[model samples]
Target: MFEYISSLWSQFLSLLSSFNISSALDVLLVSFIIFSGIKLIRETRAEQLVKGIILLLGIWIVANIFSMNMMKTILSYFFNFSVIALLIIFQPEIRRALEQMGRNNFGKKLGLLNKEEEKQKEKKQRCISAVVDSAAYLQERKTGALMVIERETKLGDIINTGTVVDAIPSQQLICNIFFNKAPLHDGAMVIRDGMVYAAGCILPLTKSNKVSLELGTRHRAAIGMSENSDAVIVIVSEETGQISMALNGVLTRNYTRETLQNALEEYLSSSSEPKTQKKIPSFRKAKKS
Candidate 1:
């Protein structure tokens, strides 16, 4: 046994010695590919399927070594067809992975240049101003309104629940929607890409224990929607005529027009701004409250 192992070790050393720089590089590249592929499949639903495939391959290797013809033949046939089967089973995840890779590449190409970032900041300010003005108008008129601003996460599913208007956002349009006699008075409005995408959209209600009883269904819905997506929700109470804002499931109440505008700018702005600017006034002081 010692002599046999010595011979095998000698053969391995000889093979290694014969490998040139290109051959060594090829081995390294292949190893990296396998390692990355394994890592990508791990912790996913694909992991179990991959394990099954590996188990079958192991069994086939053992069968071949033992000269078990039938077992080897069956395993080989299953292995031959597994490529198509795996693709079918993991299609969605595969597509998502590819899409993520494409986005990463695209984002790298866009390289956060200062000018482009400044333009985005400007656009966000415009949107914030529009929303704040609308909220102030609605609060004064006692017009109940729910406005959701989309953030990082896509609100495609939520947006589908409402009518798709895709109109340019304005204070007048928003106030009209929540007016006493308007058809969409009861439903929430969704804003995306600085546009009012839809109105009369129903939002989910929050079930959190931390929510205050002072909040109505509209406020609760705003909080609920924010909890699910990174959306900013502005609520104008119909009964109290107070303006409030919700983000990350937390509701801040009694926002004055000036404070509301500053808060919107602060929250929506991509760059660092003064923290003091975001502070909202006490709700109790507001006449609407």
Candidate 2:
């Protein structure tokens, strides 16, 4: 026991002596990277997948300790094959991660992109006003409408589903697009950088069975689009003329002209902290969809 204790003390002292400012910095950098990776995975679907992988690794360790040849062989084979499977499964997430890495915010922080961002902000306000006005008009007359406003997350996929409008936003134009009997009324509109970017676009339906049966296709599509991206979606129900807004998968309903304007203003403001995404509270809780 004394010999073992002496050996540990000598090793510990050696390690302490070798430790320096450079080593501390190296440890801090590695720790920061690990923490950031955990945060990123936690924010996405990868968290569950990572947890499953860790569980499998634990089981494999146990199997090895017990000398379970059958279990060990199966787990080893599965791990050997999992690399390719994981690449395919996490392609989207991997691409997003790479894109985020490439997007150095130095330019934006130095106000280099301020001109473009400011223009976008102005355009966004215009689009918001047009949407709010159109929604009010539709709600009053019970015209169903679906409008998607893109934010930082590029919505090129969603935009491609519809006819490119590329027109300046106006309440009259938005109302006309969704005028019930209009050709594009059955579809959705996409607003990017405050421009009427696309119309008559088809949106993906939410796969979540959590959506209420009472909701229609427009509301479901809005929720689905919001779930898939960081866009703000507005829906005007045809049947009840109810106004609803969806952001980050949550739907809030019963928005009037003033309240909807306020909600949009609150959410659409440029956040100073670009590292963390922001979630705004709803004006009012809609039906739990």
Candidate 3:
């Protein structure tokens, strides 16, 4: 045992001796990648998968230590084929990560640099202002409104279910679309690339059983859409005039016009800014007796 420990120590020292600037850079690059991957999947369904994978890895390590050949062999086979399994299981997350990477400054400069990229900041700001103004208008009169803001995940499928408007957003235009008596009042409006892409769109209803019974179809649909994609869904309740936002499967309610604008701006600018824990206020409906 002493000899084994001595040999291990010698190997470790030898590795340290060979480490140079290139080795340090290689370690840093790998560490950055791992950190970025974890950050990408944070608070997502992929997080649970990572936990499960870690648990299985622990079991496999223990099995090997104890010479439990059958268990070790099974886990070995599973791990050997894990590349394909990971690809299949993490498809959505992988896509999102790649999309985010492509949207970043580095990727933009590398491949997608254009006038559109240069103008996105200004355009998105205008859209946020218009949406906030419209939400305030609808909230005052208790007129229901559902707006889905497209992010990295393309919402082409959702947009196809509705009538294409493909026009610049304005307060008047948005309010008119959800004016209760309007033709598109009952359906959702999808905002894409800072334009009012579609209206009278059908959104998927949430499968979650834990949603409050008080929430109507619009809110459920908003939550459902958020669950499937990274899009931000803004909702104005017809009954209470409550303003709510759904993101990453979490529904946060009770946003005023000011708060709504700030939240939207923050989330919209997330790609350009350093990520931090910006907690939007949350509220749960009171249960009936």
Largest TM-score belongs to which candidate?
Answer: 2
Write the residue-wise lDDT of candidate 3 on 164-254 in tens digits: 9999999999999998889988899999999999999999887666678888899999988876677889999999999998876668788
Q: For candidate 1, what is the TM-score?
A: 0.56
> On a 0 to 1 TM-score scale, where does candidate 3 land against the true structure?
0.72
Report the candidate with higher lDDT, 2 versus 3: 3
Worst 10 residues of 1 by lDDT: 278-287
Q: Each candidate's lDDT (Cα)?
A: 0.74, 0.80, 0.84
lDDT tens per residue, model 2, 1-289 = 9999999999999999999999999999999999876765664567678889999999999999999999999999999999897898777567656655553456656665557777877887887888889999999999899999877678888778788998999989999999878888889898877889899999988755567888889988887787666678999999999999888667888888888888787777753322323222223454231
Q: Output candidate 2 Cα RMSD.
A: 4.3
Query: How well does each candidate superpose onto the true structure, as a TM-score?
Result: 0.56, 0.78, 0.72
Q: Cα RMSD (Å) per model?
A: 9.8, 4.3, 5.6
Candidate 3's displacement at residue 157, Å, is 2.9
Clashing pairs in 2: none
